[model samples]
Target: MKWGRKSMLVAAAAAMLATAACGSKAGDSGAPANEAGGAAKPGNAILATLGEGNDNLQGKKIALIMQFNEGAFSAQYVAGVKEQVESLGGTLQVQAAGNNLADMASKLDAAVNGGFDGILTDHGTAEALEAGVKKAVDKGIPVVAFDANLNVPGVTVLQQSDEEMSKQLLEKMKEDIGGKGNIVKVWVAGFAPMERRQISYKAFMDANPDIKEIAHFGTADKPALDTQNQMEAILKQYPNEGDISAVWASWDEFAKGATRAIQQAGRNEIKVYGIDMSDEDLQLIQDENSPWVASIAVDPKDIGRVQTRYLYQKLHGDQTDEKVVLEAVMVTRDALPKDKKINTTELGEYIEGWGKSEQGIADWMGRSDK
Candidate 1:
């Protein structure tokens, strides 16, 4: 599912155009006056401008097409989108393609043909989604892509800064391993964010000669199995290589798979690190016998909310920056308070609430511009 070199070029160009055209002044209403002719404060003026725009989606319809809704992460994203769209007075129609590229294309066509006001998709591969995105754009539908590389023209991506996430994960790995280890990196294929993680990880490895990457491969859909298989094979090949200090995964599923393989083999010397703060992964981190030391958490609900706000602004003719990147922080089990425990449901709620907040939306829009 990897994009060919030509497709990559086209995607890059499309992304540049999409980002450049993100801003608009069409939706702005007259600024509110502060007592006759008094100048309005910056914050108040911003709020007034937003207020003047139509936030009601009472009759508007939104379509959300996911790469696949098989995992908790994808489910959380879809839930966030539905909740936010409803809160904004809109209806959300969701479709899952189960990782089938052709199915995604068909679903997107249906959404556009059905007159959905906006489309939200989880990008699986730049090339695979390109045709669908082009169709949506041709039909004047705005697209908000989540958790994938979106270099498509006229598309807005709602996801974390890939480079930043990778940097945080690598820094944490260095901290846990004391900057010395033979690491194996397993990444998600066809996902742009995971690709970026690999790029950043290579940079980190180059900077730290003490750390060596033994193997690097892609785990497209079955990330967990991919991780397990890759790790198992590596372990068998390097059965006596005691210097393997860590296993780095670009996603929690990969980390979990690696953990399972390592545990089965009774290798306690290897530490695991990854991104995506899934609840199950968090529990493992908290487990006394778990090998997971740290992870970078990007709240999917936050991503949904942010994308909604941006689409709202765009729909109403508001100016926005072309690319938005959110920050992620590394979480370590040792950093948790002694009395605190990981709560997956609570974390889900926290992200869900974000999708319902105007402020959250605004903040996300502001960040997206940069």
Candidate 2:
């Protein structure tokens, strides 16, 4: 949890494994032109080649349960999963919960009873689904949690490392704001990863007294709305409080909402920061007129592919550790080379290459063990 040397070493190994496992099959052509940890231009050829060698997944049934089918961001993740599942020769049955815990529990139970070989779940309100997950494990089914958090005992892997991601976001925010500003924090309830992000942000705040959290939007089902309302309320109460300099939401939607409220209030001084590398957020950062500053890019497509690969390996008897945490890279428009703009079109291609490359797949597989 401290992210000490041991943690870094482990994370580094996982990253290596993820990179290596990207392209691992014959005639698989989506391998990125650049090496892992390197940069490459994005293109359609890359998307076409996504998940080439993942055919090893043939003849398997992978049940996917998403928190909600809404949002382009969520849709992309599901698309990524579908692509990987098909490439690996696995069949996918997707069910959406519409952000309802009861629906999620019912669907999860059906997946288990229907004899799904493996299960993929996006982190939601785990408390509501904890019992359901336990029941699945009781039936010898392995579950992979992505983007969200659930403390289910038999979870083959906990997909993302939120603490590290949060730290990266905070560091980027400080750099974007020139290292000193008052910040507001917001998060969603039962979304474990966001909770972890809040913890990391709190740590950063503790170390930097100058950066105080004036208000917090506690976790809720629709955290973006709650966060927006909180920001609006704060701006009204502190009308002239020029000290409020930044708004940090745990997710991009919340950040977007906060930005909207700030703009409506005619406060252009407050910068906005958050996670989830959503296209809208990226465009906002790219816009000269926008107050959006930076974000920690979490490639859901890549996360889906990696999660699938890990599950496949585990099913095939790979000796993986109990947890796999992927580190997210900080992304700012300023960080992009002037010659190389952020290529939204190339994201799928890059991820595809990462998923198909042999070394990339191996590297990602290794991360599970570490």
- Specify the highest-lDDT model's number: 1
Model 2, residue 99: C-alpha shift (Å)? 2.4
Q: Which lDDT value does model 2 have at 224?
A: 51
Candidate 2: residue 219 lDDT (0-100): 29
For candidate 1, lDDT tens digit of each residue in 205-255?
A: 789998888776534445566567668878887786465888887777778
Per-residue error (Å), model 1, residue 280: 1.6
Best by TM-score: 1
Residue pairs in collision within model 1: 15-151, 19-322, 23-320, 24-319, 27-317, 57-89, 321-369, 324-368
- Quote the RMSD, in angstroms, for model 1: 11.1
Lowest-sum lDDT 10-residue window in model 2: 19-28
How many residue pairs collide in each prediction? 8, 37
Clashes of 2: 37
